[model samples]
Target: MAKKRSGPSGKRGSYAKGVAKREEILTRALDVIAREGYRGASVKEIADAVGLSQAGLLHYFASKEELFTEVLRKRDEADLAFSGFEAVPASADVRDIREGYLSVIRHNAEVPGLVQLFAQLSVDAADPEHPAHRFFIDRGALLRSVFADALARRFAEGGVAPRVPPETLARIFQAVTDGLQLQWMLEPDLDMAATIDVLFELVFTHARAASDDPPDGRAVREGGAA
Candidate 1:
């Protein structure tokens, strides 16, 4: 006698299992990359850690580039969760945002391998045809938008006007962060968290000054009178 054929339920179960397995691969890959530098973390190592062969891992991801990109994507999700910035409330203080950003940097200082991967991928992703290109582009836009929204809200509510528009400030923040990461990679002793903290202080001070000075170059009095 022949064996029975499975129906739609079997297909669904298989699909669910495939998704779970892919997730497991990405999670394990993240750990591997974090522990081993980008150059050291080979596809075989990640596959081995996840109990999969190179071919098996490629079955889950289209290519090695896609796999590494997914790992970076997972890293971003983990960072957001760690910073708690995803759930920031309207009533939250602006300083909380600064702390969240600093915390992520501090965490990065501990994960040199992921940082290396990010740097390499970002530069390579500059090519339009690269697998990680879309990921980098989308990540930049999303991060800038989130930062801008938070800054705009805080500036309006706190009565402090920034020297630059919130959108521009957001770009500046992003650029400074990327630059600092590159610099830190070169100089392992660089205190990224401290540097960013000082940057936040400078930004806030300038914003406060901008808020205090009127358009006519007159300083606003204590009670808002020019």
Candidate 2:
């Protein structure tokens, strides 16, 4: 038998390189989409934004749909950044929640355009024929479940309280974030971070009263109310 070519590593390297270039193109392309609606965004347009000729951009991305799909996925992976948030004990003080909330607000500011893009594309991803349709739907469901679990864990100790059942509160959590993002997108001049801070303030105070928990650790230090 003729010797079989053993070139798996070469194929793997090629795949990795292709993926890297695709991501680079999509990373730049998202900004283009954010500024220009999907109708206005074409391969040539994105290529121009990144200083690439239309042909060169097309060589890496075969179609506008492919480019947009990759951009949406990259945006999700970037924004699904809630690490260390769940680590705060169910009994964590108000200060922990306050700090974690601040971190989330800071990250949103860092990617204002990307956040706006998601708020727009979310509707597009609902159609079954849309490339990212199923992915977005499934992701939304998973996120809701995960957040609900976190709320449940937090309240399980009886030291924490939620105005409604964790399941209902979970839906409220998603709705509030979505509505805020939409409003902020419409009016970038709005102080989204400050508004978020106020919302949390009200929520925490109510939870404290219902759970009969002590004031936050930092509140004790700064003479602030939880």
Candidate 3:
């Protein structure tokens, strides 16, 4: 009668299974929350959707807030993975990054549920006590930083100065993206990608025109013409 062997392999197997179950729960939870919202989806409902009892779900996640926090984290991770930035060359400039954003927006259109989830959670997270408050705050800051850096790079590449500061431009860009997302949610027919492109064009054109102007309000003389 050999002694029971609970070796490293056994532990690894258990860990892998736990990881798989956790991901399954997160996936099902997203679907449930997308359909029912955070307040409407009870612990039991989420558990049942993942083929677990409420108590079993609690073993993996302490509470509904905890579960929802993990879900939001996973959602952001998924979005970053699909953002196409990783495929961009190291030599890529601001315009390249800006173009990448259009692909992300297009992808978001295909997942209205995820977009709705983000919109709803972002609103709910406005409360200081909410679990997702910090997430959204940090997310906004990160977006502003990335956009500012990209815009600055673009301006540098073209030897053009922006009419507005890069940070200010970044905020405006972020606001437009968020506002458009909300509008698109309400009016599904809205062309969010095209609208964002128009915004980029307007901002870039203004910056470029400003860069081309004479600082002393002097007009450029044409060749052999007044």
Candidate 4:
């Protein structure tokens, strides 16, 4: 019989394996970085945790910056999943989204090392040539867009009203969240989530007031919709 060719299936299997290993490395890296601050989580340390040599780890990523950028990307995906943004309801209530956002902030408090890493990388990524510069730029715009879009929906459908424009409010929220991370790092006792909640209340006072009104009022505003 003629020799059989493994062909595309072989290539696909190898690609799948490579992807799985990369994910494993990222997951382990998150644990290592969460336990050990960015300064402590050296390349060799991450390599050792993943049972790979420095060379092997480096082979997977073009550079350390690329690896860290991927780490932040993974963190974002995990955060979205945790915050219920991955599967938000078609008509999600503002209160529901607010709680989801607060939950993510609360989760961040438990991962101080990651926050430290993020703070450091954010500063470093300010350089346009840095590997993470694009990531941060794109991430910021996307986050602001998502928040703005969600608020716009609420304003139109949920009868919520805010003094500021949705886009501006989104930018303010992002700024506050990022600034709070730095403050929380300096003062561990800072209640970042609660502070954000208070900010939300102050900015969206009308939203809260509307939600609090009797069912009759909400029904009229929402046209008896959920």
Better of 1 and 3 by lDDT: 1
lDDT tens digits, residues 61-155, model 2? 64655567678787666545463555666555444555665566566755665575666667777778776677677776765666556656656
Instruction: Report residue 74 deviation for candidate 2 (angstroms).
Output: 1.7
Task: Judge candidate 2 against the unseen true structure and give its global Cα lDDT, from 0 to 1.
Answer: 0.64
Clashes of each: 0, 0, 0, 0
lDDT of 3 by residue, 99-204 (tens): 7788788877776766776777788788988777888888878877777777777788888866567777777777888889999988999999999999889877
Better of 1 and 4 by lDDT: 1
Off by over 4 Å in 2: 1-10, 30-42, 49-63, 80-102, 110-112, 159-163, 209-226
Per-residue C-alpha lDDT of model 1 across residues 146-183, encoded as one tens digit per residue: 77777777788778766567767677788889899999
Scored against the true structure, residue 101 in model 1 reaches a CA lDDT of: 88
Candidate 1 clashes between residue pairs 3 or more apart in a chain or in different chains? none
Candidate 1 regions off by >4 Å? 1-9, 91-93, 213-226
lDDT of each: 0.83, 0.64, 0.76, 0.82
Model 3: weakest 10-residue lDDT segment is 217-226
- Residue 199 of model 3 has an lDDT of 83
Q: Candidate 1 or 2, higher TM-score?
A: 1
Candidates ranked by lDDT, best first? Answer: 1, 4, 3, 2
